[model samples]
Target chain A: MPTIRVSANGEAALETRDVRVRYGNNEAIKGITMEIPRKRVVALIGPSGCGKSTLLRCFNRMNDLVPSAAVTGEVLFHGENLYADHVDPVEVRRRIGMVFQKPNPFPKSIYDNVAFGPRLYGRPPDLDDIVERSLRQAALWDEVKDRMNDNALGLSGGQQQRLCIARALAVTPEILLMDEPASALDPIASAKIEELIQQLVEHYTIVIVTHNMQQAARVSHYTAYLYIGELIEYDDTNTIFTAPHEKHTEDYVTGRFG
Target chain B: MSPADSARASRHFDQELQELRELLLRMASRAEEQVRNALAAVKQRDAQAAQRSIDRDGEIDALELEIEERTINLLARRQPMAGDLRTLVMTLKISTDIERVGDHAVNIAQCAKRLAEALPVPDVGDLDRMAEVSTGMLRDAIAAFIDRDAELARDVCQRDDQVDRYNDSVFRGMLSEMTRYPGAIVAALQMMLVARNLERIADLATNLGEDVIYIVEARTVKHHAGEVVSDVETEGEFDQ
Candidate 1:
């Protein structure tokens, strides 16, 4: 399969060329080729078991830990293939961070959670400034500044998710991959996370996997619809929501079917 | 089976959508009736019948308001997408077009009342023909909307040129009659106003047809229908 470059300006932050993932005898992701533009949020949406998350994990090489899982094809970050022999998985993960579905903050204090990633790199000279800046970038600074010493688990589900975002930001990753980050929160908290996503695009490229069509429409600049491990359509969010070219995408987004 | 064949999982959402469709059809029916009554009043030269047509426009106005309120409620509550979203947005626009059609009907009825009071009734056969074509377009445009037939909608758009030609001929004939008979100026001018109203009604019907095409095909046919290779040349012909 040929690489599909969706962006016209040749400024893709990440590009996947005919990538597929297989676990033992079962193929979870068929071949998909796409480009994620710099500083723009790209949303991958589909029904459950459509391999959206599996495709996301390929970005940071999180699938390397699975014993039977195998990823094939090229995943390029800044013109360099990530699956090359010499690249370190730990360094790749630090540069391309992830926030999972549920907020899994460590049992340490709020200050410690935000400082965790930076500490892994042997402690920067401006560690306090880095922690405060990451928290502010995640939009959780004012709420957690007074309780920096408090345990992260003591915070609300929404606050804890923001802390996780802050932890990811502390590493100063060039790209952020979020997997259903707001699904576990209430309406107000979900709206706050959405607002944070809109702001974060100014600093980091984002690729999000979401089942909520409305959330995908609201947060992402570009949207790709996946079905049965294949990419059905990918276009600007306004075009996808208003006048998608494919019938399957239209049916899925309109609540007619999955 | 296609995905659209699968019913929306939310039963209440389906109910609300059906209700909106029914109300819009009802309003279309009422507007069509007003045009027929106004044309009938002109044929009979009865001021009382014209007054009746003018008075019924209030009902169309009220229906427009009701449809507006219901559309806003659905948008806020249901948050529809794709086809449902297009349907809701098109409903709001089509209702406005139907309301304006009602207003044009009222204007024609008022012209009928004025012509009834004049000294001599002028020859209005051309005006009658204009009304016939305009009303047929309106009725068929509404039918196209009901059936979601883009072909029928395109046919309706093509018929608009015939109405415009009729309007031009009526204006020229009225001017010639005024020159021949000075005492009949008032009645001739009233007939001219009637011709103009019919022309506007035809334009509104074309608008309705274009909207139906939008809802069905998700492509805009407005302001560029001429480029679509129709039998009629609709470019730079009318201000619309």
Candidate 2:
């Protein structure tokens, strides 16, 4: 895990303290102590099987769905330990939403997909306002506002991904964990998602996992490089890309290793 | 990247980077050759050689454009990071410097053509010394870039003062000669311009040396020359 450095005037939104995850006998995340500053994008980048995704899943307890996965150590959300045996995993996920690699929007109508999260938790009196606000925040309202009743699966791959992001926003999440959110899209669509991420950081803290080092360099303020289940280096995105301190991080960023 | 670790996982990327380096070095050598030809024309009063040096500036300009195209293509396709990125950026900048060096050489060669036509050309020994120092700096700067030697680059930076002193002495001597031999004032003024061009070349060479230090150590020693104690002190400050 990388060291945590708070923003100039704000505290960390999420802090992981020596967090480790083990799948049966294989230790996926060796030990990480990273901080996600409020309203900033922190990207986790590494080669395949480097445990960047496993460490990302620890944020909202997504790994709990796997029976073989066992997590130890503290994940703090706004100073509250998330794994203290009393917090509801559902509530944790509601506050810290996720977007997967593939755009897995529901087969329901486009409007219904954005409303799913809010309705599942509790119907608010301003449900229509919530859906509109979420769609607009995701930058997809103008494209899909007229097709509210159309099936979400009918949208393009990029639109489906934005709908997933709108769904995550519908719950009013404080943090968004995205795993390869634009890997399945073309260059244009990937650029749109990256732009939306830049806009979303104003309202939400984001932790993204990506194999695209350039994307991480373009979108994130802080970057953490993981290698073989270990945190190799973490620093400002500019520093990581231009002059990384660790030799391993430098080698990886410069494409010097296989 | 270290010497052994400079090779990338992709051999194509390595080949492209090597090609860029070779192109830059070729431009540097051509610029150096132009300076030599220009100075030789002045020393021998040969108008044809000076005209040849002036005409050859177009080749250096074309090479600059080619280097720029290759650098842009590499940036778009490879998205080079860290040292590779630095190398591409520095290549773009150094190519421009070399092209400008070629221009200065042309300016000296133009002055040489005028001096060859004028009457009673003054002694060009001071001008020769200035050319010798400036061209040596240019050669050493390019050598420092090829070897990735920060120490040698710093040494190049320190030698800029000597070239400046040579330029001042040449200017003062030319002014005294113009006062004594008012009939040959045109040639004296042209020789002064040649010295000025050589001085500018030295300055550009120092700029190239600073760029080399930036590439090798990733620390800028350009304007902060007074603060840098030694090259060793600049090594571990990569975070800056």
Candidate 3:
């Protein structure tokens, strides 16, 4: 119901048309249709179990990992139907990367963790260049550049999250899907990731799900308010925070939610 | 109460907002009473009544400072959004406007005190009408704020020009009175000053109207023509 501009190029990086997901007999995501603008951050926010994460997973087909889940409708990446029969779910994930809430880095060196994704497709001819670029893009290169061989788990929680982001960025994904990416870290660490998301948007379209309304207001260009598995309102960040169209969105963002 | 709000347990933030609303209403009531008493002082040339009006200006000033502190504290503590955010910001603005109106009342009372000592000038008669219009606007703007009625606030905005018209008439009439009766210069000048204060109050009332519209509709109707084309539809059930 909200009309939003996708990007300067006028092409949406991702879109979902009537996409719904049911885990066994329970519906986690109701049918939701929205455009995710290119090279910008769009935050999905709501109270617990409002399907913010479920909708974010829909973008990269992470929902497919659950055997009980059934997805109906299209999740398009750059105008291509990702659910098409001939399409490979594995390749769909490669082009559309994801970062989870916890900083789940592989038990390897920082360089190895970043290189793990690119190494899977058989090492690129310039693997060093790819790892460096991804680490730099994730805003973690400066912090971990000297210790590229240090175990990722040894890094602080925030650095580990950035390392995970670096891992996701290594494969040169067109879009990034993050599920509560900063909720686990301390405020200082969380602030760094939020700042990183702002920088990342210049090169990649980022979809983030955050329970912190202030974080969503800080980092995202647009905000979507989901309630009871329904997209209640989607609008520009200013409108969502200061003058949302739906009272439900107003109540939730204002911390009046039950 | 709307079902959406009633279903949720009340927040301490809600109590703070309620306290803010009550403070704003009390301040507005004091400002309205000041205008009324000041105008009565002019009509009866009652210096005692004018002094009474002047005495209350400090109370309004203190209330404005208190509102500012509470609103700013809530903004930082609660990080309020949507209607709650608008209400806090508007409270800051409307309190300042009311405070200025309080100052204007003191100015009018000062003129009344001066006129009480001067030779009588024939009544310009416009002061009484201007008094009525400006006071009515001040009263209704606060009502619209309390009631969250954009239509009533818009009506108050529309009445502003009427007070300005009366002010012009009072000035022209005073010009002739001073010219016809050279000895009546002091009285006529004080009367004109009273009219100017009333006009100022009306302008402040118009500002209150615009601030009320902002809170109710999330729209700016300040510089626009009387037609306020804003998204005013904020009604319906909120899906839980």
Candidate 4:
């Protein structure tokens, strides 16, 4: 009966209330309340400086790493406030993983890359199983199972991106935030990342920020359209793409302007 | 060469477009009025007037075909998008419905001609009401298309059920009258056919109304049951 009930999963995988992020001289994100269900992909789309990326970073306190960044909001996961007084920012990040706009695989072997996160936090008795499962979940196990010992830097850009996803999954985060994860790759590789994000929705709540409106339409079940640091409209992907209610939203989706 | 001359040139182009729209409106209104007058002739049992109505329906047919050709040419030449596409599509659909309206008018006129020889004129109050409502539906539906009014289009769709109800009553009345008087069978059958034809005209008007809605809202309410009322968010986590 709640106004924004997303699933019967007994808990919202991620929920934000009055979330705002500010820089020293200007505000990057205005107040935004959004709910993403467990195991679903929600795409955030807008023009440059629309604060989609700023809002994406708020999920795991990535904004905190910024020197002048200030945040005032409640971002909850599984009914508990992530920024509560006693919650560790480091532990919060481990629970909610992130991928960047460009692939940032560490300078290490592919095997060591996927194994790094699990090696850091996973139970030692199950390390090998964890690494294999994570790589397979990222859809990279078959390609890299033979070259597990090869350097990640030698992998193609797309492969390296998937390796980064494997690295994130290795830690087994409940939520994965990807900031334009396919912007650097070719269309084919971008499509692969999109397909992997869709597949990942079975086990992890995924939030994506992208300038590609069609990509957002293809990958997300729900879409939030932002403009000028404000959430203009949020609706099912099909409705937003084909029959948006707001004129502004329609103009943006139809390529009237950025 | 002068600033005033340049202003006059821009005004000429604007006037040309306005005149184009005016011509299209004249065509649409002519087709709409023919539908109303043809139905009126049938309900009044005025064979002379019905013949006149039927004869005039050729103009509507000619206009419908002309409009369709214009719409096709507009697509080829202008390649319109967005609202222009909607307007062009509405014109195409409205003209087809207008053609069907003309056909129904011809049917009613033929029925009036046959009934004049066979029977004393029967009271056709319900038939008159059906014609009135149906003609109004057509008029309003065309107006909606011209104005791009979604609300008026929806109202026309709702009014069709009323017209249909009157048509059914006319059919039932004629059926019982024929049963009561064996000699009246031929005339009653003609009336029945006329009523069915008018019902068909109303149905075409409904089609135009629904098409207008599609042009405006991009939603097909036809064959769609009930009102779509709410948006419910499913369980999920969205990072705001």
Tens-digit per-residue lDDT, A1-258, candidate 2: 343343424478998888899999999998888778899999999888999999999999999999999999999997898888999999999999999999999999999999999899888889999999999999999999998999999999999999999999999999999999999999999999999999999999999999888999999999999988888888889888987777788788888766
Tens digits of lDDT, candidate 3, B18-39? 9999999999999999988888
Candidate 1 chain A — worst ten consecutive residues by lDDT sum?
Answer: A1-10
Predicted model with the maximum DockQ: 1
lDDT of 1 by residue, A44-140 (tens): 9987788999999999999998889999989999899999999999999999999998999999999999999999998999999999999999999
TM-score of each: 0.93, 0.90, 0.93, 0.71
Query: What DockQ number belongs to candidate 1?
Result: 0.48
TM-score of chain B of each: 0.90, 0.89, 0.89, 0.80
Residue A71 of model 3: what lDDT?
A: 92
Weakest 10 consecutive residues, lDDT, candidate 4 chain B?
B230-239
**DockQ numbers for every candidate?**
0.48, 0.40, 0.38, 0.08
* Stretches of model 1 off by over 4 angstroms after superposition: A1-5, B1-12, B228-240
What is the alpha-carbon lDDT for the whole of candidate 1? 0.87
Which segments of model 3 are wrong by more than 4 Å?
A1-10, B1-10, B228-240
**Candidate 4 Cα outliers beyond 4 Å, as residue runs:** A1-10, A122-126, A242-247, A256-258, B1-129, B176-190, B207-240
Model 1: docking quality category: acceptable
Clashing pairs in 2: A1-A32, A1-A33
lDDT of 3 by residue, A114-206 (tens): 899999988798999999998888888898889999999999999999999999999889899999999899999999999999999999999
Query: What are the lDDT scores of the predictions, listed in order?
Result: 0.87, 0.87, 0.86, 0.76
Interface RMSD of 4: 10.2
